[model samples]
Target: MKPLLELRRVFFRYGKRSPYILSGVNLKIIRGKVYCIVGENGSGKTTLLHIMAGLLEPEKGEVLLDGKPLKEQLPRARRLIGILFQNPETMLFNPTVYDEIAYAPRQLFDEGETRKRVLESARLLGIEDLLERPTTSLSYGEKKVVALASIISYDPEIILLDEPLSNLHPERKRRVLNMIRSLAAKGKAVVITSPDLELLDNICDVTLTLSEGRLKEGG
Candidate 1:
C-alpha cells in the first residue's frame, strides 16, 4: 500500500528573505503508526510539520497525501491533514473552550457535525466540563488539552503534533499518550516532534531525529 504521507526532498523557507529551515528532507509515514520526530531545539521539527499539514508551503519538493500533491492544497488536502502547534497559546483565543474546539469543525464540517465533534473530542480528552469555561481562563495544561481537542475535532486522516506532551501532568500525560496510540490503531498517521527522547521511546513505534535540517541515522 502507498504511504499515507510522504515528504520528498522537501525544502522550506519561511519568507522570501528568510533562511530555509528544512533542506532536502525525505520522509515517508505510513498509516496506523506513530512516528516520533526527535530533535533538539531549533532543529526544524515544527517547520516540517507545518509543511506536511499545509500550513506552510515548501520552497521546493513535494508533500504527497495518498499520492496527491498537497504542497499547496487542491481541496481535499485539509480534510486529510491536521496540525497542532508546539505552544497551546497559539490556539487559545476564543471566548470559551467550547468555541475554541468548535472553531475548526465549524469551518470544515457541517453545523450538526461540528457540535457532535466538539463534544466528542472534549470527552475523549477528558475535558468535557471545560466546554463553557473561558479559554484564556484555563490553566496552561488545560489549554493544551483544549488545543489537542480542537485538532482532533477535525478528524483528519493524519495528525502532526508538535510537542504534545509539554506542560501536561503525569496522569494526563499517560491519558493523552494512550489516546495518540489509539489514533494509530484506528489507521491515522501520527507524527510527533519533541525533544524528549524517553517520552518518544515509550510512545512511538518509530523514531527519527532531525538536527540542523538534517536527519540523524536511525532517528
Candidate 2:
C-alpha cells in the first residue's frame, strides 16, 4: 500500500529571527498504525505536523500525501489529514457543542450525512450529552473532547493529534486513548505527538523520539 504521508528533507522556521524548528525531517507513515512522536517541549513535532497538515509551507523539501506534493494537492491532503491542535480553541467558535462538531462536515458533505456524521462522532467521543451546551461553559477536558470530535466529523484518513492527553484527568485520558485505539483499529493512520512516553508506549504501534529537528524511529 502507498504510504499515507511522506516528508522528505523538510525544514521550517517560524520567522526570520527565530531558529529553525524542523530541519531535515523525513518519514513515511502507513495506514492502520498508531505512531507516537515524543521529545522535550521544544522539539519539532508540532511544526512537522503543521507542515503535513498544509497549515504552513516548508521553506525547504516537500510533504507529499499519496504521491502528490502537499502544496499542489491540498484538497486531497485535507481530505486525508485531520489535525486536532494542542489548543482546543483553534477548533471552537460556535455557541453549542453540536454546531461545533457538525461545522466542518457541513462544509463538504450533504445535510443528512452531516447530521449522521456529527451525531456518530459526538457519541463516540461521549459528548452527546453536552451537544447543546456552550463551548465556554465546558471544562478543559470537555473542550478537548469536542475538538477531537470535530476532527472525527471530518473523517480524515489520517489523524494528527497534538497532545490529546494534556491537562486531562487519568480517567479522561484513558477514554481518549481508547477512542484513538478504536480509530487505528478501523485502519486509520494516527500520528500522535506528545512528551508522554508511557501513554504512547502503551497504546501506540511505534514510538520515536524527536530531537533537534530529526525524528529517530523507535527511540
Candidate 3:
C-alpha cells in the first residue's frame, strides 16, 4: 500500500554556513499505526516534524503527501495534517479555551457545527469544564490539553505530536496514550517524538532513533 505521507532523502540546515540538522532522512507514514521518534535534546526531532508538517522547507529532498510533493500541495496537505508543537503555549492564541479549540473548525464549519466540534474535542480530552476559562490563566498542563483539543477538533488524517507527554501528569498522560490508541484504531496515522524512549513504551508500533542527523530503525 502507498504511504499517506513520505519523506525522501530530506536534508535541512538553518543557514548556508550552518551544519545540517537533518540529513538523508527518509520515512513513510501509513494509516493506523503509531510511530515514535526517540532522540536526545537538539537532535533535530522537532525540525523533522516541522518539515513533515510543511511548516519548514528542507534545503534538500522532498516531502510528499498522497504521492504529491508537499510544496505543490501545501494547502491540501495542511488540511490533512495536525501538529502539536513541543510548547503548548506556542499553539494556543485565542482568548478563551473554546475559541482556541474552535479556531480551525470555525473556518470550515458554520456556527452550530463549529460548536459541536469544539465541544466534542473538549469532551474527549476531559476539558469541557475549562471551555469558559481564559487561556492565559490556564496552567501548563491545561494548556497542553487545550492545544490537543484544538487539533482534534479538526480531525486531521495525520497527527504529529512533539514531546506530547512532557509536563503531563500520570492521569493526563494515560488519557493521551489512550487517545493515541483510539486514533490509530480508527485508521489515523500518529507520530510522536520524545527525547526519552521510556516515555514511548507500549504505544509505538515502530520506534526509531534520530542521531547524527539521520533516522535509524530501533531506539
Best by lDDT: 3
In model 2, the runs with Cα more than 4 Å from the true position are none
Query: For residues 1-219, could you state the per-residue lDDT of candidate 3 as single tens digits?
Result: 899999999999999999999999999999999999999999999999999999999999989999989999877668799999999988989999999999999988899999999999988889989999999999999999999999989899999999999999998898899899999999999999999989975899989999989999998
Q: Cα RMSD (Å) between model 3 and the true structure?
A: 0.7
lDDT scores of the candidates, listed in order: 0.86, 0.87, 0.94
Q: Model 1: which residue pairs collide? A: 207-219, 208-219, 209-219
Cα lDDT of model 2 by residue, 1-219, tens digit: 888888999988889888889888888889999999999898988887888899999999988888878799866558778998988976789988988988888888999999999899987877789999999898888999999998989889999999999988887787788889999999999999998787554888888899988888885
Considering only N, C-alpha and C atoms within 3 Å, which residue pairs clash in candidate 2?
A: none
Stretches of candidate 1 off by over 4 Å are 15-19, 72-76, 217-219
| Candidate 3 segments exceeding 4 Å error | none
Scored against the true structure, residue 36 in model 3 reaches a CA lDDT of 98
**What are the models' TM-scores?**
0.92, 0.95, 0.98
Candidate 1 weakest lDDT stretch, 10 residues: 71-80
Query: Candidate 1 vs candidate 2: which has greater lDDT?
Result: 2
